[model samples]
Target: MSIKQRDANKNLEQTKSHLQSNHAIHHQAKKNLVQQPVTRFALFLLGTAATILGIYAIARHFSWWQLPYTSIAVIPTEAAQASLPPNINTNFVTAVVDRVGPAVVRIDAAKTVTNRLPDAFNDPFFRDFFGSQVPQPGRRTIRGAGSGFIISPNGRILTNAHVVDGADTVKVRLKDGRSFEGKVLGADPVTDVAVVQIQAQQLPTVKFGNSQQLQPGQWAIAIGNPLGLDNTVTTGIVSATGRSSSDVGIPDKRVNFIQTDAAINPGNSGGPLLNQQGEVIGMNTAIIGGAQGLGFAIPIHTAQRIADQLVARGRVEHAFLGIQMLTLTPEVKQQIASDPNSWLNVDEDRGVLVVRVVPDSPAAKAGLRVGDVIHKLNGQSVTEADAIRQAVENSAIGKDIRLELRRQGRTLNLAVRPGAFPTAQVE
Candidate 1:
């Protein structure tokens, strides 16, 4: 009975184990069958994506489609163009420089300087011992440079009076590199205007514009040898016009200045101030210290008139009253009375006091006294001393000028004919 039972159990166990192995194999085969279709689909998708990326890269590398070019005309309107930088129209400046730069010149003035040698060097024994080694009276050249512009084809140049003043010789260098020896035709310190004559014919001339028509906020350009920089250009707007000489701190000069914000330095004194049309409107003159964007120029009309007078006769003759005067104010009157040494003692505080009347002059001939205060000139109120001088200068030479004076607290009207102003005795 035991042997039969054991043999049956072992056979049953073998059969169960065989069935479990077959079931395990069938499960693995079913998993492989299910995963095969998904693997193939994933590989196909990856290959298609790679192929599409390669095609795109090739198309981009070969410039398949290029961006369209844009023209300025296509900007549509001014409002759209307003988004652009302001200096885009710099071509106008470049063109103006090209047009007028050739006429601009650099003036180098050289003066003869003589220096005396020391006593030791001047000794006869030292001179005998050291022949050429001993120092003698040495003559050295002192040179100064300024700016100017040609005004005529026959080589008439315009510049400031201070530029070539006291210069023994003047050398002009044009922008095109031509050099010429210039002769000072005339120099008027009253207006600070000078005329130079060169020998060249067919010289380029700058076009002159009416400075009276110039308005503030108009474009102004200054081209000059500022600090010896040739043709250095600066741009700004016209700040003002008809600026009095007193306003510019140069009461001695009779200029009605054109004020601009364009940079004006030491060497820019005689350079021409050009308008937006590339025409000379003024002559660059003075700049105030401790101030930025404050530059003054002499009006071209005044300069032109002076230049005309100079060209006609090597000199300008202004009407002369021959009197030193001061604008009498309350403070000035009190200061004059308080100072015992003061000669200008006036009773009135609201008139121009005659400080001194030159001997044998028009004012002296008109019976103007030191204590007399001028109230009016030709019916115009004389609040400033320059007003009388300006009126006298504006009147024709030899014409009778009427002056109202307060002498000893009494108003007196006097008439006198003006005479030619001595150029040497001018401001």
Candidate 2:
């Protein structure tokens, strides 16, 4: 090959490589321009038209952005929340806070005690080390802080029974800086609602709202003295209702808890959980920590009833079913299916099984026998042991109800009368 030909070929190759690189660079520059802010903005306006139209035009309802926006977060307004069903309400949050805030009080509990060695303490080293003169530390009283709400204008307070259960002294602090030494009224173990008294007049009271009216997604407000910060208010929505926990055992229980997402913490116990209308719907009792959006409240329906009894007679009388029951798990359901006609003590799918019938109690008198699977009572269907217990408690004592029982291959209906529950004795 000639030297001149080789040199010409090299020059051609160099020009071709330079042109390819320039074309690649120009193509990338055009692509980058397509992703610029101007281009993206235009696309957003065009693509978001459907979303915006649905929000603003197709539906006239207000959303988070459409509702009044302000930097002055003057507490959440329930009127801003969407009402359930036909959606006809406004300013629930305001009504709730306004009606209940004054009634919400700061509860300060202190224990006064002299420590004594346990009666069971018998250490051999203690006898030798001090020559029978071992000095044990003196007992000291401890103080705990919590919150509660007044149920009456005349100084009756509603709080968790545990809040002042064993306290030597309890101080109730009002919003107006009035502190009253509280006297323990009566506490119920079934619902954990307690009534306490203060030696004062003309106190602020919170109006009780019907908890059964609370719906899922309704706004929930929590007011309490959390971490010693009095009058702390937090907001969320009612996530659910009718939550039951075995962690706190109450057989023949009528507790129906309202669950909320409001930030309830350790000191939130005994505080009023108000609905958007600012009405006391439940009492903040517990928080499942480490997990977000899990908080529980004692429903006001039971609380109010218990409070009335506590205030009037100092105790609540209950009815006895006299039957031990258990929740039907999946495994139990299969066992139940195997004998559709046989009376079952264990059912994985349905009603609580009547385990042991108390000799002379309501269940025994009502003909509720062992192995009888209770499916419904008084026309209401029973799904589990809790439902059975709740239904029975909610009903009046001495009332006769039709019970549906599945006995050997035949569905039997029996009528049984309930016995009056024993009155609670509080010390």
* RMSD to the hidden true structure, all candidates: 13.9, 16.0
Q: Any runs in candidate 2 off by more than 4 Å, and if so which?
A: 1-100, 112-142, 245-253, 329-331, 335-349, 356-360, 364-369, 407-427
The whole-model lDDT of each prediction reads: 0.86, 0.77
TM-score versus the correct structure, for each prediction: 0.71, 0.66
Model 2 CA lDDT for position 356: 74
1-427, model 2: which lDDT tens digit per residue?
8999999999999999999999999999988987899988988898899788777864565556776756644444544343233444424555556556778999999887787776534577666766647667598888888889987778888998878877989999998898899987887776777888998777778777889877899888999998988888899999999887543333333577888999998778899988766778999887765878888899998888898888888777665666777666677767666876855544335666676787877667767777777777777777777776677667777777678876544577887777666544210
Superposition error at 385 for model 1 (Å): 2.2
Q: Which residue ranges in model 1 land beyond 4 Å of their true spot?
A: 1-92, 115-138, 288-291, 337-344
Q: Give the TM-score of candidate 2.
A: 0.66
Task: Give the C-alpha miss distance for residue 257 in model 1, angstroms.
Answer: 2.4
Q: Number of the top candidate by TM-score?
A: 1
